[model samples]
Target: MKSSRGILCSAVLLIALLAPQCFAEDWLYTVRKGDTIWGLSHKYLKDPLKFQEIQKYNNVKLDRQLPPGVTLKFPMEYLKFAPAEVSVSAINGEAYFVRRGVRATLNKAHKLVLGDILVTNKNSSVALLFADGSELLLGESSELIFDVQTKWGETGMVDSRVRLMQGSAEGRVEHLRGPGANFEVQTPSAVATVRGTEFRVRLDKEDDGIVFNEVNEGTVSVQLHENKESVKEGYGLITSAKLPLAKPKELLAEPKLVNPRSKYLGHPVTLTWQPIDEAKSYQVELFKDKALTTLVHKAQVSSHQVSLPEVNLGEYSLRLRAIDKDGLQGLNTIHHFTISPVPRSPQLKAFDEQYIAGQPLEFSWEESVSATQYRWQLAKDRQFRNIVTQQELKNNTHQLPEGLPAGTYYWRVAAGNIHGFGQYSTLKRFDVKRPKPPELSLSDKTITTEDTLTVDWQAVPLAEQYLWQVSSDETFSNIVSEGKSQTSHLVLEELPESELYIRVAAHGPYNQGRFSETKSVVVEPEGNGKTAFGIGSILLFILIL
Candidate 1:
């Protein structure tokens, strides 16, 4: 009887040795009927003398009888058999697991067994990590079974296999360097076998039990019934339970921007892109940020171009994607841009006034915000039929070049930036007045004892009156006579006999013209007394005759 009992104890101990143990921690046990402290120590620790230590740790009386349904704590040295299970590495939203027909909510750090079934609710996801550093990510509304096999007394090389019943799953299989090691994901329609690869497998119930497999990093072989295809990186395959496995196809590359490659700030912007192979349509989205979180505009078009309406002015981003015939969207290509309103029209600072000819006309305008330059034009007519001067100036003011003709001129200014020019300001009119001097002439150059002297001048256009001046000095500082006349002729009642100077000028409403050339005249006194007596005798003879 003792021999048989010893053999039974050895078998129990051997079974305990084979099971995994909790690493560096204590264990808890519940007491059952016919459980004594010494018997429990001998069964768990193989040392009956440790019962006194257990009693001291639990504060139990050794002489008293042991009671059933009592809880006892054992140290790590006395406990064995810590089961190996998968761990929940991450969880998003709501997820649950069914282990051995018992349902529980899934959380980070939760352990899962071989037959454990993980389920993700709507908008929920979870990631499972195996001991060999492999990962399986269950997407929303997905169901997966974790089937992992680990070699006894080994540290690595786990055979990882997952059965996806519905929805999508992404896996990153770690490389195993041992014999009889494998990693695979089996769906309802197809099975994906991978080694050290990053892949995604999805099963759609609405698509008649179709399975989609995509490899992102390494090669993945998709097997469906009697047909199989090896999908490389940047490739995908599709299969259905009712049909044969389809060949792998290359994914669509990112689209390139054809227009507005840099910053843009205008209305009705037309965005264009390079077309991709096998693309049925394109989706273009505009965001207010580079991260594409704030959507400003979104549109889908069959062509490769789309026109965006006016939006608020600020920074923005443009994202484009090609849509295949099967409604699958390819990778997104995002480009940044800016939106700014056109600059305001510049306000002219000049007014309708008269300026002298040959003087520089300084044109100025109000400074517009965010304007980089200004454009101005000078025209002779109101309709700009005769453009005299047009220039692009960097500053708010510009000085007209010298020697501009005297006439009525119209001018306007417009503000501009990197985008384009804005509306032109209201037209401003200005006149340059420069009246010519009248040409003066004398009827007689010499006048001796004359009763009257007359000075005449050529008529001047737009001259309301003429000004005549007689001066003794050449510089006309000592004016002997000065008068204004309505006509071009002027009569002097009396004139000095000495050499005299005469000049004329034209007077208009806006300007007083320069003086004309001076004319000189000289006068001589009468002869002596002898010449007077002879003249008296001749006068008497003529009276007699």
Candidate 2:
């Protein structure tokens, strides 16, 4: 009897050791706006039909629209065994997690537990391990639940918030509504709150204490939990739980007052001011009135070379401000200028009909009233090479020097005065197309819903029309904006922030050539109010020097 009992005990112990293998795997996936079962199956299982198995096990009926902010789970039997796990924890109101393998997603209703570790997969599913070592893994391609309620024991808590663990997880928050409806995330030291808005949070361990929070729309508040310090609008916050929180300081320097100077209409504006140390770039805003009304032109440039546009006989107010990448604005430096009676539109007629290699090429544009000098450039590629000629011309004709070459050449011209220069003329490319229409490119290609799409492209020919277009499909059959000019290279209005397919095309007359080849741009619209304070250190160093 004793020997038989010993054998049974050994068998029981063996089964207990192998219990983990019996559980299989669990996954968490959040549903986005346009997600389909077919997409989910192919994404996680490499077969759309596999989604059926997942749905049956998860008790989800087929053909249900997996709306945004929904969380779903996949069982172990349907998955292929490449399970991953991550850990997570909640401090303050936000829940933090890390993904190891597989994938994970978040929905609006599911509250993330503090000290939870998650494992992820390619299908955007997640397995959440709580601080108490409890596990909750989602289904493949299922909607996520992004809700938070801190229950002291078994009762539900009110605030619902979570930090991104890994992979891409996007969702909406519905319960946190109204003026007092507050949702937030608390790092070890920092707190991020949502103010009637939708947003995205991405986790990148490689970056040092940098939490990339993007705002698709509405406003978010990133505050130091210890100090309640926060920055508003479209800004980024870089913080770490290991470090103590500091007061939110604006990193922008006060702009120097540019000397009040006279400007001539139809001429390049010579704007010279003491160089600022920490300035990443300068923004020049030209207004028509002393009250700073009727903003005529605004441009952001590293070097100050703003060409005032041809005005229709009126006095205008000018205000210039310098901004760092952190979105901090400096004091506005104001100036005044007047446009005397000028022609309706200035014209640049190419003097040379064609470029005869090895011969002098003389190009001249028709002079406008109140014009003084001309800015000209010669180049091989779109970028100029030789002396960028700025000549004080009483007359319009400029002589091209003899450079013995047997190939085509490109030249560009711009009219300038005291305030600034009018736009540069259409690049005349005898040998090739004039400086490649400013190649519109983006800072980032793939983005979440809460990010912005920064549109850029080659500058349009002076006076030529520029149009910006965006489409879910590559072929921009449905363009976004009607024909507009390229006064500003950036477009940040009414854009659906996501991994959208984008292309920009510049248009001129057929004689000028077909619209320049469409260029691609990617935009990520996220805001956390963390300014670049290091720029201050750099500026201080420059001041010392």
Candidate 3:
């Protein structure tokens, strides 16, 4: 009696261990005109003897032929299958997968298999490539487990399945090449399957009962508990774990990006869009490359605008979509904008670094490779509230207009391109000074033909020296003689035979002040033997009128 009890206990334990395999997930097979369990087993199954089990499980009599319309269920474990090929196409930031409790970093060279739980860290992403040309993007802060990866033996069929544990995933599934190929994403609350097209699945973070789903180009069948909903292209739905799935509704329309352009100029990048009627919020994502495999930033904004954090200067890509009241994100539209950093405040190389208020004045600064144009401004106030002159130029130099009068002014320049304008250069304060001419007078003008002549004037406050020129023409265009003097007076001994014009100007280190009024100097030979003027002594007269 003891031996019999032990045998029965062992048999029960064995049956318990074999129960899963005996009643695993079913692989439905439809009967054809000439189909039979024995023939199918002979052709596709490893052993023909399993037909009895199939007959017993499906309650069908063992026969050479079965009805054409009858569909039979067979345990999937009994089918011969091969591992479906899956490869890592891209990985940005950090991503990993665990297999058999052993962690492995995800990379192009790493081999992935069934039961690998893929995880992406914050600000990171991973891209997967499947044998059937389907691609999947595991988003940041997401976890996914590979539940099934099988390629049935030479049957032209492949099945790829994953369980989205948290966060979200995006997929671009190729149209199924042959019948029976399947791509599926599972969540705690829902299971979505697609034969071909673009789709997205995310487990709701705030509500454990809700699972969000969207279909962009193809049909997706979402199964929630006992109810199954067919979500066609351009539609989405939020399903509850326990309740039946409602009909899929049209997704929120894509928002028109406000002033969408291919370039972005400066920091704190602001992206805005026209408000959609039913949209409650917006989703914005920024990528470093056009492939969108490298996620740099992402946000869910309640308003129509989203502000991007400061990033390095380079080309980038933006993905924008609208979110409805149910928190179902709509189809996304990718916008390519190059973060063409406004050129760094150009190194200023201004002329004299001083403001010269006059006509035809020029201001020049350094150039930048990214700048297609430059904005130069001259303002009367340091804050540039009162602009005196401004210009947008393709070159680095700007020529001031003719109307500015002498005054203290400020000027600055900034770089720009098709993308936008950069920050203005450092505030520049240049002083435009127009020095006044000095006062001149002839203190000692009395002279004779044979006596030396002396000309005197008041000392200029800022002048370091005085410049006196002797010219025959009143305009002094043809100067005959010129000399510099430290004192207020100049002694002129040698004089030309003809009448001469004299003028003086105050000279300083910065610039020579305006010239004083011209004077007339005349010499006469009192006697025939005495020359008109000589360094030794001559009678010379300077007349001022």
Candidate 4:
């Protein structure tokens, strides 16, 4: 009977040792060198004799020594501990996790336990997802500590708390069905508690103790010590560690785009927006695509309108947003616009192939639809090496400043707008015809006692009349005689007793021709009867000798 009782007692003890306690907190520890079961139990449970309980629960034989790297499980009856309720879903750059005074590099799929602090290096970022479907995203140089008050298996309402020690964090909390479910985030100067909402909390690294909270979707109650303020969607609150909570202020509204109106690319774009009453300033951003990922330009202005610099020929997108006095940004208002292709060259209008010199030359061309201005050029050479005249005219028709010299000329025109100049028009040829001068002949080269002299000239093709002039000098500055002729001949009845030079030219309706070659004549005085007798006697005496 005694042996049977001992056997029954041993069976009960074995069963108790093998069965795990449902309510006890458990920890998995790896054994190291110089670490004994008694020392571990004393350090963890504060009782050295509790080592026997660890030995019995692990089914370790008394004669065998604990291995250096063997894993052991310890159940705590008084202290409660649990596995991490959150996991690191994404990590970028360098990040670290600290738990129970042990720090390790944070990586994807790493579990985050309560009271674990996560730190992100410069230009690094981390994202965490909790078992309750809440998410937290940390910006660069940020520190976040998980201080959840609820476990994964808890049934009743509990609090989900996170503390931001430095930098910024954006949170999206899952909706809670129960009454007591709460999600709260605390910074140095402010604490934001919400039922469920999308919000951002930032602790200023420069100011040491300043905090800011912005609600994006739902209401958030921000508390600074004993003072509290409720922030709604599209609003924000700011406070310092020692100051009272400031009143919630309205964020700027999305700007309304006024110009561009779905136009093509290439022209200068005038960006206009409806001004907001509470906005202190505005920002304009231009992107290469609709997604707005590739930024092309960014400008800040106090006015509601801005004219963008010349952009290339392509598709583009523009966005506008307002900034309040406190630097809180409003919702973005986006617009899509494109630059039109370059304008086509203008078509030239029909014009005369020949023009008279010293007459007004009018140039005309067909209007280009997209051209705001037209540029025309007239050159002496086909390659435009010697440009005669060039002008930019607003209208399609332009009058030459003066008639070009008599020569063959090449001309072309191009259309242009704010974007750029288009191709040049096809080259055109024209000529300026000069008037022809007449050929003059004198009836007498020498006039000895003659009272009349007649001058005749050949007829010019386009000449309406002829002009004759006689001068004592070659320059014709002092004219001795001048006359207009209907036909090709002119007669001078009164002769001067000096050398004379005469020339003739033809005249047209528009211009006067060049002068013809000059003809010379000399006039002499007449003699008396006594002088005639003396001259005849001298000639007769010479013949007789």
Candidate 5:
């Protein structure tokens, strides 16, 4: 009885020790009354293959299943995680500070020096916030810094701040996340902030006296110092030690003129506006009769010059608006000017005249006011592409080149002035005439007797002489006579015995005009045929008759 009681006590001690192990919980776990080894294994261990692990841990047989009220140790391989933070630094000598509800972009890698701010926006204008929940917006040619960095932790925490130095810029505070996240912009004299909406702020490098702020879209509360303060909107707050957020009524300060004679009536014009009251830059708006023509120029400049090319006769005006770094415009102003037209085109006349072949004529024309040069083009065809002469003449006259081929020629001239060259004059046509042809008449049409052949013709109209020939086969190969100078007919006293052909051509100054029709004649003795002399005489009479 004593041994059984001791065994039972030992069994109870072992059960208490292995209660957690038998349950299969990897970490600490308090045993519950209804929990069993199988239930605990399924709940904690999960893997069915590891069900036997409980038996091995307790030094019990596999067949001897897990018992209730036993402890077990479990391994730790399952859990969940979260995203880390991003690392950032500053650029240039600018410092940064950040808290919450702020965002911005860093220009380069840097260590934070000053300014508690965070990135509120990264767009055309970067927004930054201060520890006091103030806001600053950066425009083009602007730089800023942030305070928060990834070294502490990278959990997307609002950590950095920024500052705007040197260039033109704007700032606005929409809504602060809390009282701790206050936003502000620091210049030489004033720190500006807004309760809601948008506003602009600017600072100058050379002189701190030019620091100014404007509330374009929202209300801005400004503090020049702890003692002095003011709020401005739809207007600007100009600040210095003397004036703390003071409101000036008239702001349309005159812009300095840069090159006065920058453009002419026929030249391109460039107009530039000057910065006013130490403002960072200015904008020039050009108008033609009150209509906005162009926002001609914008820059951080003291003056601007506009170019106008070939300005017509009209009235012109230019209006300018001065802008601070905050994008606020001052009163609109105007600069008036005038433009005039140049003189009319010059006149030209091409004289008409006839010329002989190989002879040239002189061409001249009148010039108009302001005519500086003349252009002459001459050609044989009307198209003028076959230009025989394309010369720029300082004088209004040019003699046509001699030895031009015999043909009708066309020519014209143009005048050039400051504005442009005028249209060419009407083309003039001239002729180079060739010599004329002579008139001619033939001699005789027929011949009867062999011994005598009488021929007759008339004189050529414009000829010095006539070219005459007589042939037998109608080809005029056998010439009875060469060119004859006589005006009347020629007698072929010693004529050929065979039939003959005769032709007469007229020669004149130009060419041979026409030729007489060919005439045929048979030259055979009439006598000595059939009673010779008497029969010849009778045949001759019969032929003649």
Candidate 6:
């Protein structure tokens, strides 16, 4: 019989082998009363004659049946297993995987095997989740290959290996439970091996054969042909075919946005940010989601200013990072901004008019072709809650009625379509300072029976003209004759032989006063041919009193 020690020379070796292979049960077989090494090898081992190999690892007799309850340790590598699987948890954009040689859509429940290739289109990404809860994000325009997918049977340990052929990928590896757990990423120029970390790997698009590696959490070891460098959290490095593994360089500081009036108000959105000391350039990216997985725009700029062409107004997330002279992109600063689509406010003409109480006010604005209508508001305050007049009309001009209490008033106009409205124009102040105009009074009230009737009104001070109307009714809605006269005297060309109403208003340079009180008149022609006539039932009949 062999000694207590099998092929294992020391207890240290046995412990090393036992601890890492937690599935050591997979290598052991229970001894039965009728079991022999000869019978067991033929049943379990591929080569039956290799029963002697089992004898080297376990002190067992081949010539007799082994005692019951005894256990035999077999090599784990020599055992047989099937292809392993990685559960596909999620995907974004148009990402697919090719199994063996058949292309298929990658879904939540899809399982990927070794030799499977994952691909992402432009502006797309894919997320791969392994059975061990490790997650990997394959970035836009990327291709990744599953090199090895294996797990020791029920050992709670996994060995995952993937090769990035192009573009970028980020990973969040679960903490290893045992020595058998490993996650590795291999690129063209370098390889990254991590026990548990959050990291990113990118093959430089500049065709320099450079691989960029960034560690956000835990530690990552980057290996070139013969050199290796350990990158810790908050640090990054780059490796090229021409150079050795580089020392981990601390990432640059994030750039801070410095625009105070940053509503993203106008076209060609322009934003400025504070510059970093070591930054040679900056990269700006926009995403629609807060998680920043959906990339919309990416650009590299030399200055601290970020300018983007007109984009749809909505909620978005932006990422800004500075690039150093060593071609390493620094840490990112993320922010949430909203782009609200609004129409342009119409331009208003200057308000230079003398205002009077109970007088018409005219306000006009420049034409806006984009607006189908305009909203004009006359308010007591700028907030427009205490509004005097608010209306939406197709025309650009607004007319305020008479009887506005003469104090400081505010007015504004905004252009709008069916979709939405734009910003309101600057509040305009209207100071009602002009005095009420003087009412015109007729000096000569005598009646005349002639075909032409003449009436004279008192010429008021600063009166430029007189506007008189002869109406058939008292309300002056049915005006029979109307004319403007420079003098205070008005002559009626024709006088109807019936009851009529006459009114007149004095006009100044810019505005006209209210019409005078209506006067009812009836003309009586004498039987004798003469210019003298009599007025019958005339209100306020007096001799120029």
Candidate 5's error at 390, in angstroms? 24
Model 2 per-residue lDDT tens digits across residues 78-119: 433221222332111122233343243443344344333433
| Superposed Cα deviation of residue 414, candidate 2 (Å) | 14
Q: Rate the local accuracy (lDDT) of all candidates.
A: 0.74, 0.49, 0.77, 0.75, 0.51, 0.75
lDDT of 3 by residue, 266-319 (tens): 654677788888888889888888877677888888888887887788988998
* Candidate 6, 1-545: lDDT as tens digits: 24555554677685553332334434566788888888777766546687887887796655476789887876655443334688755566687889878898777777887889998888777767786778887888899998877665554557788999999988889997654567999999988999889888988887637988988789999999988999998899998888877789998878988863435432445678998889999989877767665567778899999866556777778889888898777877888876656566678899954565545678888876568888899888878889987889899997765546567788888887776666677788877654444444443343444556666767754457888888878888888788899997777755665566888777764346556777666654543343234443243367445
TM-score of each: 0.39, 0.25, 0.56, 0.41, 0.28, 0.51
RMSD of each: 18.9, 37.3, 12.6, 19.4, 29.2, 15.7
Model 5 stretches with alpha carbons more than 4 Å out: 1-162, 177-181, 242-245, 248-281, 284-320, 323-545
How large an RMSD does model 2 have? 37.3
**Cα deviation of 514, candidate 6, in Å:** 27
In candidate 1, what are the lDDT values of residues 319-414, reduced to their tens digit?
A: 787767765545567888765566766888856478756555688889988899888999999988899989998999988656356788999887
| Candidate with better lDDT, 1 vs 4 | 4
* Model 5 Cα shift for residue 49 (angstroms): 41
Q: What C-alpha lDDT, on a 0 to 100 scale, does residue 137 get in candidate 3? A: 91
Model 4 agreement with the true structure over 341-449: per-residue lDDT tens digits: 7666678888888876655788888988778888899999999999988988898888865576678998988888887666677788999977667777888877755
Runs in model 2 deviating more than 4 A are 1-245, 257-260, 267-270, 343-545
TM-score leader: 3
lDDT of residue 406 for candidate 6 = 60
Q: Residue-pair clashes per candidate, as listed?
A: 2, 84, 6, 7, 62, 0
